[model samples]
Target chain A: MTTTAHNPAVESHGHEHGHAEHHGPRGILNWLTSTDHKVIGLSYTITSVLMLVIGGALAEVIRGQLANPNGHLVTMAQYNELFTMHGSIMIYLFAGPFAFGALANIIVPIQIGAPDMAFPRLNALSYWLYLSGAITMLLGFFVTGGAANFGWVGYAPLSDAVYAPGAGADLWIGGLLLTGFSAIFTGVNICATVFYLRAPGLTLFRMPIFTWNLLVVSILILLAFPILTAGLVMLYADRHLGTHIYSVAGGGVPVLWQHIFWFWGHPEVYILALPFFGMVTEIIPVFSRKPVFGYKGMVFATLTIAALSLGVWAHHMFTTGVVLLPFFSIMSLLIAVPTGIKLFNWIGSMWRGQIWFSTAMLFAIGFVVTFLIGGLTGIYLASPPLDFFTHDTYFVVAHFHSVVMALVLGGMAGLYYWGPKITGYMLNERIGKVQFWLAFIGTQVFTIPQYIVGLNGMPRRMAVYPNDPEWQTLNTWSSVGAIMIGISTLLFVVNIVASWKKHPAGDNPWDGHTLEWFTTSPPPHHNFFRLPQIRSERPTWDHNHPEAKALAHGKEDH
Target chain B: MRIESKILLWLGIFFGLMCAVYWTWSLENAGGVMMFFAMGLCFLPGLYYFWWSRRMGYRPEDDPNATQETGAGYIDAFPGSSIFPFTLGSGAFFVVLSMVFGSWLLIPGLGLVIWAALGGIAEGRRGGDK
Candidate 1:
């Protein structure tokens, strides 16, 4: 409520000489008590990288187990735990939080012509809570009975205390609850920051594509996560307090949990993808060296995707025996319209413009191709008949990995593209292009065979398969491709570490139009000196060419 | 210097006693039925209490601020920022009542209705302050 004018005193922290002395805090105390969003973002990114390795290792375990029929690499219980942890880590901890919690924290405030987040302390709290929740979840593995093996969904009856008795399930419920709390709190902070902290002339329409997508995504999180938390509470009560929320013995429907979870979970899918949409929007314009084509259309498409995402939760439940077919199918098909509109805008943004084929742009363009195929496969899954055939098969895995993994990969691309701007150092571009090509090829080689094997009735999560000669070649191919992804990712790490000391890109290397490019690369504690008045969606355009600005607004020399 | 802590202690003890009695009576067999009946009876009065609380000199400062960069100052920039005084309070009362009575859906249903009504009022009165 304390209103203060824009003050440069609040914004100045970096000395020109100090930039060379490591801008972020160093050592243990620096990490424990740090409030800088960049430091927190780095923490999240590191954790996500570690989890990706863990998730990929689990995939190797899965591949080894499925290498031959009657393979004894791990017990069924252990296999369940492995896959559950893999899915949980990949979707929730790795991809979901990185795209939003890390990137949005580091980027949105700067892009929106603000200093740091409106609530920097609360931002720190969100990260700490998330870390606590993640630790608790990992502790579930070391506990007496081992981690929750009922998959990340923790579907009822399987998750019921009667069937899956122990502290394992309880720990899972508790950890997920804490994680959900972190997500909700982060959402609230982001939403409030975007809404209340915009610079004077910056209206909602004029927001950068990334910030716009974040605003939409954060609102989705706020609306969706609370219901998920409520459902988790109900699930916890059933496990610990002997409640009948989802217990069949107590007349509670198991499918109710699915309904509530997917209600959050489906929007969760968009929450994962929309920021990448923003990334693409931002990158296309910069690399193209033209104004983003159809900026209003892009914004509308984002909102449309968010709105449509909410109604399509039941698509995940199509094979649950009692799920309504026509309703979910219709909703699923309806989502494609908005998604198609977004694709059109992306393609339109790049058309007939001078294109820069940087690693970031390569990955962005790769996303379109991979995501397109993923979307086409999704349409097949939308139908009840096709889903019946494809449920729990490698084909579904292929579809999800194509779209969702592309999102993660695209987010990484954005990081490399913007990290220089954010940190005031250039990343080794040579190594980055290598990382991009390897990831692209690895993704195709791994996923395409899975699609074929899945079509041939190869079920997922099976530790072993009969020496069905058909699946052998494909599985081998997938394994090899996984190794490639692993290697490429390692090279990416090497590139980062090598460049950390030497490579430096002064502020605004990309000559970008967004507000983030206004300040010094790797800005201060309080972000900007003076947040410029935003009259159009592209304020940089307005500033650079007064004639164009006058012409666009229909104001002549008079 | 430490006088405030003693006062907080006394107030905590008083609330603890009231809560103990309420919980014990609600969970016990014979007393629980009576408690359930009493709770059902209290719903109307509880709603009226909330209505009265709205008319009190309640400020937006009473609610937790959504953002933290304001450096732990609990007040947000908006006026009339709370629906908590009505919904959270009413929710607690209903939850306790329903728990005692064995009605699973009562509290959540009532909470939803109250929230809807509040939303209607807010929407109807939009921009009046501005």
Candidate 2:
């Protein structure tokens, strides 16, 4: 390891002069074959955005069909296809990939000061696998039966070749297996990089909140996604291999699908959730002008949630009459404690501080408020008796939309927060704020009406409903809110286009503390020039204001 | 590294405890075994880190006296560029299509995977192309 005449550390290392020597080739080759994490990450985000558009369009069709009861805008079969693709694309394609695939790839390595992902080529491979999987799934739209209508969960007997009997069902299985494996590979890389490649002095406790979240999330993904893959394989076997794993006529238990799916499904919530929670955690402390209230508590709470999520899958299956009610109900309820701790930590961080309400901060605040609603409503779902009334109702729909606010609002916050850093361009603040408020109001208008209708016994995933006046009014208003959301999302794209390559975001635009802000706005090929002093979690802030007591050097908040 | 290993060790112990509790709570539930695998997942990486940290001793980061410049050196050699990822993905894609298209794809699908593996390995052994 010594520096010699041929030392890469001196002549070739180039850190003494600053930055790694090459930026590599430009244009398509760099994107296609280069193993740079940033390129792959940006590819992930872009693909998710494209999928988001497709998923959103499908939502509009669903709303169009449901705006009035007994509506016939789409064929009944097409309505089924629309909702199924909407859920699958939003969950598997947009939400999960954007959080874990894009955000983790972009931030984790930089946060740890690693040169690149542990498997740089595999990182690139993830993007390709993701793209091909997405295409494979989208290919269903053109097939004869017009995509899988068995629902995103693809429950048993319903999803069998006998019931579905479409190429779409087979395509759905193939696409997910590829994307699922892609995710599992990404998890392995993140785990390896974080465990093995932290910068000197960046100890476990000293790692950034986002990095900590990635570590736990990678573990969650590794542990959870494989079950989904295995389950899908069994489903495929039942479909193509002529097996009876889920077919009742062949002596298969239908509840087995519920067991297998929920085992992977429940943890998938946290797998998608923990990273945005990480992003919000990072954004809150920075804009609040304080160190995080409980860094260690945040870490432990994240770990606790991951552990509890494992045993609580049965909570989703309580209505099936097969789940152990007490054990799962208790475990599911215990998750609230850790989640509550995190909420309080965020609130405490903002107390009495010079809070800057940037668009990112605004989204973070919105995420906090909405995530609370999502979590509290989940209590009813966790109870076996209570769930009997609400399962498969619009109450569940409202709950889901609220829960994904983390992915929606929290994701928007991360985009505003990190988007500048990634692109080296500042998004228009005025436009961003306007989009934020519209989306905020639209989300409330959208979900609250559903809660009312659901309690009135309006079932979910229904294309046409009986014409009832109250249900009609609520349903129409919900469609209005969906359109508002649609417009606000379009405005976000306008902001991106308007801001691109215009106003250059100088390094440390937010005056942040993490290792990411220590480098350039977009950073370099190697991600660092000269390493900043890594004394504590707030490295950049420490380097800038050496004597600052607030988020100062060497001050660990126990 | 020391703290990370300890944290993961505790998490491993925690998940292991849950596995035992869930198993004792319900003998026929298969989800208990999932918890067992979760424990093993944590311990495998956690213990590997623990052993390696002990073998290599504390990095300069863990040493309080280490200065900013102490970590200034060559990072690992990042692969400049590689086409095998695309090749490997294509290979895997064809294999996935085998699910829809029948078993005939087993030949070329697996063949490309093997080809990419050999190419990637040879490139790594030869220190990769310039």
List, residue by residue over A381-424, the lDDT tens digit for candidate 2.
88888888988899999998988854698989999999988999
Highest-TM-score candidate:
2
lDDT of candidate 1 vs native? 0.68
Q: Write the per-residue lDDT of candidate 1 for residues A64-100, one digit (tens) a residue.
A: 7766566788998899888888888787777777878
- The DockQ-derived docking category for candidate 2 is acceptable
Candidate 1 residue B37 Cα shift, in angstroms, is 29
Q: What is the DockQ (computed on Cα atoms) for candidate 2? A: 0.48
Per-candidate count of clashing residue pairs (backbone under 3 Å): 1, 2
Candidate 1 lDDT score at position A428: 85
